[model samples]
Each structure stands twice: as C-alpha cells, then as structure tokens.
Target: MRADAKKNYSHILAVAREVVTEHGADASMRDIARRADVGLATLLRHFPTREALFEALLCTNLDALTQTADELETSNSPDEALVSWFQEWLVFAQSYRGVVAMMAAAHTNPDSALYAACAEVHSASARLLLRAQALGSARADMNGDDLFALMTALGWAVDQPSFAPRADRLFQIVASAILTNPSSKDIKNATR
Candidate 1:
C-alpha cells in the first residue's frame, strides 16, 4: 500500500472501531468513512464487509490483551498479577460493550480469523489462571475454564447501562471471591 493509502486505511479502521464500539456492530460503514474523513471506496478497500471489519477490530484488541496477559504472567505474584489484569480487562470490556457478542459470533464461525484469535486469548488466559493457582492465590479447584466463564459473565453483567455505576464494585467483589485471601480492609484501603 502507498503511504497515503496506508494512512487512510489506518484512519478508517480506528474510526470504525470507535463507531462500532459505541453504536454497536450494526454501525454503518459510510458513517465510519465520514468519521475517518475518507471515501466509501477507501473504507471498502480496507474492509470489504462489516464482518471483516469487526473481525479485524476484535482481533486487534484481543491481540493487545493477550500481550498484556503475557507480561502479567511474569509478575512476581501471579495471583496479584492475574487480579490486576482482570481489572484492566474489565475496563476494556466496559469500553467495548459489544465485544463479548463479537467474540461469541467469531468463535462459532470455525473459518473466521476471529476464532483463531479467540483461541489465543483463551490459551493466554488459561496460562494466567494456572500461574495464579501455582501462587496459591486462586482456589485449587477453579480451573481456567471456570475463570473464563466467570469473567465473561461478569463482563456482560457489568456492561449494562443500569449496572454502570457499580461496575467497579462488582469487579472487586468478583476478584475478592476468586482470590484466596479476601479482606474488606484491604479492599477499603486500596479504594482509598
């Protein structure tokens, strides 16, 4: 791609991501083009279909998240690292309210690149969960699958507009439940 073409493509993707995140997956490509200050032809060149654009955006975010998980896995306390990662993860989830639906749809499509990206995130999450278990921070019986389900459910629950105000509290409660050591004093102190 030429320099200007690459720049236009990048801008379209960035704007499309924001629009889709805010207005939902059904957001229009023409609107994205306008937001990006590009033409319809440019948008179509970058993403031929809405599904393609969504998959691209979703994969990009998941890739970044997986990288963050890798970094956290190397932290001194695997338990704290996992918890901290969840805090960040919840924030991301809240920001991209439709992401869970996109991930689910992608996972259901075996041929989609999003499926592969989802698998990578799942693998990275499992590693983080295992490390937390090794550190004696998580319950011995709590497997990676369990943690994954819990996190997904919690993310969806907290993503609701009605639940927005209590999202942080909800996350803290979930984290406290998962963590081996639960202390209200600690949570209070941390909040302060």
Candidate 2:
C-alpha cells in the first residue's frame, strides 16, 4: 500500500474502533468514514462491510485468546486451564458491543468474514477441552463447539445491562454443567 493509503486505512480502523465502542458493531460505516475524515468510498474500499471491519479488530484479540489457551494448557491443570480459558473467552466476547451476534453467525456460516476467526477460536479452545476430557476432568460428551455455544449463550446473557451482574453466577452454573468433578479450588483459580 502507498503511504497515504496506509495512513487512511489506519485512521479508518482507529475511528471505527472508537465509534463501535461507543455505539456498537452496527454503527454506520458512513459515520465511521466521517469520523476518520475519509470518504465513504475510501472506507468501503478498505473494509467492504461492517463484518469485515469488526473481524479485523477481533482478529487481534482472537489470536491473543489462542495464545492464552496455549499458555494456560502448559501452566495449569487441564480442568483449571479449560475453566480459566473459558472465563477469559467470556470477557473477550463482551469486549465489543455487538460481537456476540457476529460470532454466532460466523459459527454456522462458512462464508461470513468472521468465520475463520470463529473457527480459530474454537480450535484453540478445543485443545484445552480435549485435554480436560482426556484426563476425565470435563464431560466426555461435549467438545469445543459445545463450549462455544455455552460461551455464546453467556455472552448473550451478559449483553443486557440488567443481567450483566449475573455473568459470574451463569459461569458457575456452566462450570458445574461441564465439569465431571467440579472443585472449589479449580473454579476459584479460574476466576482469578
């Protein structure tokens, strides 16, 4: 990319983050362009769609989550690692205003711009999940996709301001549901 074009792309992404943080993933592209002091065509040329733009923002965090899962696997017990990773994933899911729906859509649709990112998230968590299951920690019947579903539901629950405080309670319930032998110590460690 040319220097000026690269600058415009960076400016647009930065402004889009600000706008989406305040409004939502559904925030208007035109508004983002205006905020970046770029024309709508320029914004569209870089982003093409709102999903693509959000995917770009999410890709960084998703990659971090993958590394987090990897690091946790080596640093903690299987159950603790899985629980801790899921807890962190929940927090990331709430980072953007409207990312939950985008993630959910991506899960079922291979064509979505966010699909690859969603799949990478699943793959990362799956390693931890398989480890837990192999060690008789997590329920054998479930897989990474099931955990993703639970995370999606939890994200949806926390998406509402009225239910936000209940996220921890929901997390507890989910842990109980998924763990074969839930321990207070493991759960406590995960919360940290």
Output the number of the TM-score-best candidate. Answer: 2
How do the residues 65-159 of candidate 1 rate in per-residue lDDT, one tens digit apiece?
88888888886467666676676667667777666666656655777656787677667777887887887877778877677677777778877
Model 1 error, position 92 (Å): 1.0
List lDDT for all candidates, in order: 0.74, 0.86
Q: Worst ten-residue run, lDDT, model 1?
A: 183-192
RMSD of each: 2.9, 1.2
**Candidate 1 Cα deviation (angstroms), residue 29:** 2.6
**How far does residue 131 in candidate 2 sit from its true spot (Å)?**
0.4
Model 2 / residue 91 / CA error / Å: 1.0
Candidate 1: count of backbone clashes, pairs at least 3 residues apart or interchain: 0
lDDT of 2 by residue, 1-192 (tens): 999888888888889889998887789999999999889998989999888998887878888988998899899999888889989988887778778988898887998889998988888888888999999999999988898898888887887798888878788788878889999777766666
